[model samples]
Target chain A: MGCERYRKYVGAFADGELEVKENLEFLEHVKMCPACAARVDEVATMKGVLQRVYAKVEPSESLRQRVAESLGDASADYRHRPRSGWSVQLRRLVVPVAMAAALIFAVVIWPSVDRFRPRPGSVTVVTGRIVSDVRAQHTACLGRSGGTHQAADLPLDVVGISNVLSRELKLRVLAPDLRSLGFRLVGADRCGVRGHSGAHVLYQALKKDAYLSIFTVGRLPEVVTTSNAQIFDVFVSDGGPLAVLGWHSDKASYLVCGDLPKSELLGLADQIRFADADTQDPTEPVFVRRDGD
Target chain B: MGTETGQGNEDARTRFERVAMPHFDVVLRMARVLGTGEAEAEDLVQETFTRAFSAFDRFELRTYGARPWLLRILHNVFYTMRTRAKRRPTLLDDVDFDHFADELDEHASEPVSADSVDWDQFDGEIKTVVAALQPEYRTVLLLWALEGLSYKEIAEICGCALGTVMSRLYRARQLVGRALRNYASQRKLNVERFN
Candidate 1:
C-alpha cells in the first residue's frame, strides 16, 4: 500500500490501538520505510515526554482542610429537621445570637491577632524544612561517594527494600522504575527527618554521571505551590547544586533530590507508585504497571 | 426520619471523601490546562467539587471511575464560567497534514543529532509549543498523553464521540510536531548565521 494510505494508521499504530492484523501490516511497512518509521518514533517520543511533563500534583493541605470543613457544615445542615413556626422564629434569633457571641470572641482574641496570622507566603515552612533535610542528605551522599564508589552492599533488592521500609516506617514505600529513564538502583538505607523514620533509595543514571536520592518520610508536612501549565503542587527547592522536589499522598511523603532540572525531577517523582495502603501487604512487592503494557 | 437523613448525609460525605477527593489532583491538573491560569484553575476545581458534592447522590462507581466523572464536572464548570463571562473559546480546526508531512520528511531525513541540540532548550521549546496550541486541541492532547486516558474515557470526559477524540489527538500531535520542527529550523538558521 502507498504511504498515504498508511499515514492515518501511523498514529493508531504508535498508540497501540490498531487491530492485530493491521498492526502487523503497519509494523511491516514501517520497517521498509524510514519516513514512516520516523513518524512513529516521533509520536512515541512525544507521548513519553508529554507523559513525563504531566506530573501528578499534590493539592495543598489547606484545600483538603477547607473541603473537610465544608463537608462538616453540609452534614450538620442535613441533620437539622424541619421545624414549626415558633421553632423557625427561634432559629432566626439563633443566627443573631451566634453572631453576637462570635463578635465578642473576636474582640477578646484581637490582642493576639499577630500571632494568629501566618506571614505571607510562609505557609510552607514545615514542607520547606523537610525538603531542605532531604537535599542535605543527598549532598552528604554525593560527598561520601567522592566522585565515584562501588554500589553499597545492601541485603535487599528494590522490592525487598521497599517491604522492609514500608514495614518499619508504617507507610507504603514506592520504588519507581527508572531504568527506561537511564537510571539504575544503587542501594537503600534508613533515613529520617525531624525524628520521623523513613527509607532513602539511591539511583545513578546509566549514561550520565548524575545521581538521584529519593527520601520517603513517614510524617511530612504539607507544602505545595501551583505553577504554569503543570498541575501538581510540587515544592521545588532549586537553590543549591542539587534540585529537590517534594510532594505527599495520604499515606506517605516523598522527596526526590538530584543534580537534575526541576522538570526532570518532577518527571521522576510521577513514576513513583504506592500500593493501596489497606489492601496491599507491606512485606509484599508493590507492582507498578509499565508504560505501553 | 431525622436519623435516616443524618445517616444518608454521613454516607454521602464518606463516599465523596473516599472516591471523589482522592482524584482532586487529577481534576486540578485538567482544570489548569483548561482554565486560564493557576488561580482560575484552583477556583474552577473548588467550584467543581462543590457542584459534584451537591450532586453526589447521583454518582455511581460502577459505570466509570471518579477521575473521569470529576473531569466531566470540571469541564462543565470551566465552560459555564467562560460562557457566563461572555468569553467564547476559539476552536482551531485547520488540520492540514500535507504541509506538515513535507516538513516532517525534510526534518526527519536530516535529523539534528542529540549532541548538537541542547536538551534543556528542547524541553522548554516543547513546553512552549504545547502551551501555544489552541484550547480544544490542547485539552484532548493532555487528556490522552498526560492523563493516560483511553479514547473511550476521553470521549466520556469530553462529552464527545470516540472518533472525535482520536481525530483531535492526531491533529494536536501534528500541530505540536510542526511547531517543534519550526523551532529546530529556526535554531539551525541562527547557528548558520552566527557561524
Candidate 2:
C-alpha cells in the first residue's frame, strides 16, 4: 500500500507538482529511498527533454496559406450564406399568409415544361451501349438477303429483343430516334416474308409517330435469291416511301425500318456496313431486364 | 448581400486580421511542438481567430480579452486536427533517441557554466529532446513553462481531471530535471542510467 502510494505520487514529485510542504516531505522520502529517487529522476529528464524540443519548432509559411484558403472556402459555401434580419422576418410572414398566391402561380404554367423528355441515354455507359447495339443489329441484318423489311409490329417483342440482344450479343441500344420522328418499335412474334424468318427491330425516332421496324433475318430461306425480283424490288426500291436498306452476308440480312426518306436510309445503311467484329467486351457490364413497356 | 449583413461580416474579418494576425509567430511556435509545420501552425491560428470572430456576438470582453480566448481556440483547433489525422507522419520520429542521448552525455562533461552553454546550441539540443516526448507529456510541460497556463486552466483545456493534470505536470517536471541532470553528469562525472 505504501509502495502503491509512492508510485502514484512519484510522477508528481518529479514534476514539482506538490505544495511546498508536500514537496519538502517527498524530497525527504527521495533522500532516503534509492528506487523512488531513480524513478523520479527518469520522469524529470523526459519532461525537460520534451519541453526544450517543443520550444524550437516554429510553423512554416505555405501551410498558413492553405489553411486560410480552406477556412475561406468553408465560410463561402452556400449553406452559410448570410441574410439580413428583415428578410428572415419577411419570409416567416409571407410564406404562411400567401399560400393562395403561390398555388395559382404553380398551376398556371407547370404542365408544359414537365412533359416527359426521356433521359434513357443520359448516362455515358448507357449511351455507348445504345450506339453499339444499334450499329451491330443494322450490320447483321445486311448480311443475308440482297434486302429485308419489317413484316410485323413488335413493341412488346422489342423489349424481349432488347433482352435477347443484350443477353446473346450484350448490346444496350435504344431506339428513341423513332419517337422523335413520330414512330415507335411496337409488337412481337416471328414472320416470314419472302421465305425468310425475320425478327422485327422497331422504334419511333421521326415525325408522324410512325411504327418503324427493321427485319433481322435469322435464317435465310433458299428461295430468297437473286431471282426473287419482287422481294428485291419492294424491299430495296424506295416503295411506299417506306425507306429501307438491306444487305446479305454469309449468315443473314439486316434491314433498318423507317419512313426515313430512301436517301437517308441508304446513307444510314452505308454507315452500318458491319459491326466491328473485334470490339472488346465492356470492362464492366450491368445486367438489366425490360419488365414494363 | 444585404448591406447590414455584409458590413458586419467585413467588420469581423477586419478585426480578426488586426488582432489575430499579429500574434501568428507566437502561436506558430506553440503549434510546432504539437506536431505542426510553420504553415499549418499559422493556419491553425488563423482558423482559431475566424471561429472566435464568428462567435464574437456572444463574447464578453469584460471578463477576458481576445488573447486567452484566441489561444484556447488555437489549442483546440490544433489538437482536434491532430486527433482526426491521428496517424499523420512526424519528422522528429525519424530521429535516433539513443544516439542523441549519447551526444548529450558527451557535452555534459565539459567544464562549463550554464551561461557558457551556447544559447543556440543549447536551444537546438533542447528542441530535439522536447520533440522526442509523446504529445501527452509534451503538452503539460509546454503549457506550463512556455505558454504560462495555470494547472487549472490546463485541466479545463485538456478536459482531464485535476489529479490527472497534476500528475502529468509532475511527470513533465521530472523529465526536464533528468534531461538537465544527464547533461550535467556528462560534463565531468560518469553517471549510470539512474542515480
Candidate 3:
C-alpha cells in the first residue's frame, strides 16, 4: 500500500480538497515516492482536462420558464399568504423604525469601530497578524539575501528543507512547485508571530528583484460559520507591487506574499495546492531531489 | 376579496421566481447529466421543481443559500425517478456505495504516464468515458468536480454517509483518470500509425 496509502490524498490534492496541513504530508510523500509523484502529476493534469471537457450544459430559457409555469399557483403556499389586520399596521411602521436604527448605529457606534473588531486570539485577528508577519518577513528576508546564493537552511536538498521546516515548525511543508510560474524555491526557515510557529519558505523568480514567500502556521483557529465554507476561498489583502494572500485548509492557515503585482501573486497562488499537514510522517523516505536551480 | 387572493398569488409567484428560479439552471444542468441522454432532463427538472414548489413552505433560508436546498431536492427527485422508470426497487439507500467502489477499483486499468499523453485532443473520449460511468459514480463525480460542492454538502444532498461520498468520489476519479489516460495513449498510437 506504499502508493495506495497516498493515492486517496493524491485525488483529494488534485481536487484541492485536502486541508492545508493535510496537503503538506501529501506534498512531502510525493517528493520521496517516484510512482506517487508521477501519479499526482497525472491526476492533477487529468482534473484540468476533465473540467475543460465535461459538458457544462444548462437548460434553455424555454425549458426553465416551462418548469416555472408547471410549479403553478400552488407555489403560492411558499409565501406567507399576505397577512392582514395588525400585521399591516406593523408593516407601515417598519420603514421608519429601520431608518432610526440605521441612523443610530452609524452615528453612535461606527466611530467606536475598534470595539466591534475581532477580539484578540480570534481567527481573523490571528490570521491578520500572520499575514502582516509574512509581509514584513518577505521584505526583511529579501534584504538579508542581498545577492547571496540560496544556502544555509534551504540547502541544495529541497526534500530535506521541507522536512526540516515541517519538523521545526511542527507542521509539514513542501517548498511547493512554482517553477512553472518562473519562480524557484530558494530556501526555507522557521519563524513565528506572537507564539504562532510558522514555516517561512521563500521563492525567487527568474526576473531580477522578484521574490515570493509562503508562511504557514499550524495554529489555525477554527472558523465557525453558520454553514460549510468553501475551502478555496483565498483571502486577499494589501495591493501594489507587493500583495499578500491568506487561505486555510484543515488545521493550517497560509499567508503568501510576493513582490509583484496582485495579478501575478494571484497567478502564483493558483499554482500552490493550499492544504494543511501535521508533518509527522512516520515512513521511509525516497527520491532525494532539488527544486530550484 | 378576489383581488386580495390575486395579489397574494402574484406575490407568491414573485417570491418563488426570486428565491427558486435563479437556481433553475444548476438544477437542470445536474439533472441533464444525471438523466439518460437529454430528452428526459427537462422532465426531471419539471418534477423536481414541482416537488420543491409544493414543499417550498418548509424551506427556510439557510446559511449556504438556496443552491444546496434546491440541489438536495433535485438529487432525491433524480434517483426516485430512475427507480420508478426501471420499475425496480433500486433505492439509492439499497446500494452499498463502498462495495460499489471496491468493484470499480478491482477493474481500474493502470494509469498512462502524465507526460506522454496530450489530453487536449481527447475531448470526445473524456465525454464518452464520463457518460459511460454508472449513474451513482457519475453523480458523485459531477457533484464534486463539476458542481464544486464540499464532501459534507454532497453527503447532505446524496443522503449518504460522508465516507461513502469520499469512497464514491475516489473511485469515480480513479476510473475517469485511468480511462482518460488510456484514451489519450490510444489516440497517440493512432496518430503515430497514421504519420
Best by TM-score: 3
Candidates 1 and 2 compared by DockQ, better number: 1
Task: Put down candidate 1 lDDT per residue, B55-160, tens digits, no spaces.
Answer: 7767743344666677888877888899899997886564444333332334432343343666577777777888888777888898877665657777887787
Please identify model 2 stretches exceeding 4 Å from their true place: A1-87, A90-293, B58-64, B88-119, B187-195
lDDT per residue, candidate 3, A138-214, as tens digits? 54533332312223344433344543444344343344445534556665655554355555666655554345577
Best candidate, DockQ-wise? Answer: 3
Task: Please compute the TM-score of chain B alone for each predicted structure, in the order given.
Answer: 0.82, 0.69, 0.77
Over the stretch B1-195, how does candidate 2's per-residue lDDT look in tens digits?
A: 367555766675656555555556556666666654655656566677567655655543312234445556666787777768785334322223222222222222223234344446555656666666666666666766555444555665566666666655655554555565566556643443221
Q: What lDDT tens digits, residue by residue, belong to model 2 across residues A1-293?
A: 24334455555444334444554565556656655665554443343334444444444556557556655654454226756799889977887768767676579655654565322222111111232344343334343333343433444533344333322221121211222123345443343345544555544333332233555543232313442332233244323544345553322345555444555555444333222110111111111212212
Candidate 3 Cα deviation (angstroms), residue A13: 3.7
TM-score on alpha carbons, each prediction: 0.53, 0.39, 0.55
lDDT of prediction 1: 0.59
Predicted structure 3: lDDT: 0.56
Candidate 1 lDDT tens digits, A68-135 = 67667756765674558997688788978998998987888766885765232121111112333544
